[model samples]
Target: MTGPPNSPTLLREMSERIRALGELPQTSEARAEVEAALGSKWWGLRVLAIAVIGAWRDKAWLVERALRAENGMAGGRFGHARTQSWRDLEAQTAAKAAVPMLDPADAGWLLDRWFSDEPLAFAFYEYVGLRLDPTAVERRVAEEFARRRSQQRRLPLFRLLRLRRGVADRDARLRRLAQGGDETALLARDLLSMEARFRDRQAQTPGGAKRAKVSAGAARRAAAAEALAESRRRAGRKGRR
Candidate 1:
């Protein structure tokens, strides 16, 4: 059946229902209500229902359903028909639902897909990275980074991926590229400046100062560990030679 007509009243009712569900624990009745909402003619209400269901349930099937709905509604060539806000909502809901169900292999596969389809939605890759265990996803991450580095012109998305990988400061090649005037360089500079500002502010506060010191120490340890690992890798390569 069709939902209530498009009007402020309809939106308000949907919003109220969502807010009410947010306050209560999930139940069979709540799931039924969400399912009913999904049948609504109003796209907004349908999106809301999908998001609520995905967040409330641990079922991987539900998450996949949400992902399919989002892709059909707001992705690909026909995606231009939807409002930007609607598209954003679809991406957010699908990402939230898909992340937990993703495995390291799935993450790698998705990353490969993203590289093949450069213009694909950012939320897909962003959410996968967010949920990824860095160590587990290390191989794919390194492969993607290497591929991006080989390209002559650095894309904004490439810079974003590097930022997400937390290697903006550690990767000397990327740091060198940041000196050149380009979109990636601008973004890299902005991120570095923001980090500097955060550190400065932390130093000004008593508790923050202590936390900052601890953070610095942790960073040094992490750097040392990384260096040691790289040394071992180099030694292994030499022995193989």
Candidate 2:
């Protein structure tokens, strides 16, 4: 729901903000604007709330701009409603705070983008805007990712086989996609694993260490198991169809 930028509540809030600022002897209107908003009743607190909880209007302009760009709405003259990949948009938006000195109008854009159904948008805006700059944010993110990975841990055998080539936290995302039976995720996992194996072979060739070779019997059994899994997967797809 797009509306004029200023609303009744916003106007009253501004008046209260101005009144709060005019109280001080040395404060300019701009400075007073900041201070009054910082000091007034609910209005001041609202500004503070925006700052702490990741304000869509104050800090997330770049993110909003990205969403608009992705939606092909860069001109702002509304076009035909376009389908959007919300997840990809969110990932890109979250990646923005990692960049420097984004524009302020983008903040307005972000506010417009802040719809309730977009949980990832809200989560990412909060995460990037608030948690990004702590001295230890990266460490905290890594720890959280690790915690989730551990809680969902598979067998040690799976880990050994998966990492015998080298699986990292990125693989955890792949695993999630596969569990969701997402074809894109399955294809991505296959490509990543193939590339990893190729690189491993290239490394091992220099040392003349033969790659781990599956015995013929073991290979046959593995192939049979894979075929059964494939059959089940195909059946599931067909059933859904």
Error of 2 at 153 (Å): 25
TM-scores, all candidates, are 0.48, 0.23
- Candidate 1 regions off by >4 Å? 1-7, 59-62, 73-81, 97-124, 127-131, 141-163, 167-241
Q: What would the per-residue lDDT of candidate 1 be over residues 1-241, giving only the tens digit for each residue?
A: 2356786776777767875784578898987887787777666776777667666655465545545555555456345655545655655675666666666556555655545533334566665445555454445444554556423222323433343444433344345546767544654454444445656777888798787665743443443444345445656898899
lDDT of 2 at 40: 45
Best by TM-score: 1
Q: In model 1, how large is the Cα lDDT of residue 30?
A: 88
lDDT of 2 by residue, 1-241 (tens): 2334455666565655454543444335455445444444443343332232122222344444344444443443435443233333433543344234443433433323332122233344554334333223323333333454332222211212222222344355345534545443344354345445544554576452332343322332343345345546766898899
Which candidate number maximizes lDDT?
1
lDDT, model 1, position 87: 55
Which ten contiguous residues of candidate 2 have the minimum total lDDT? 151-160
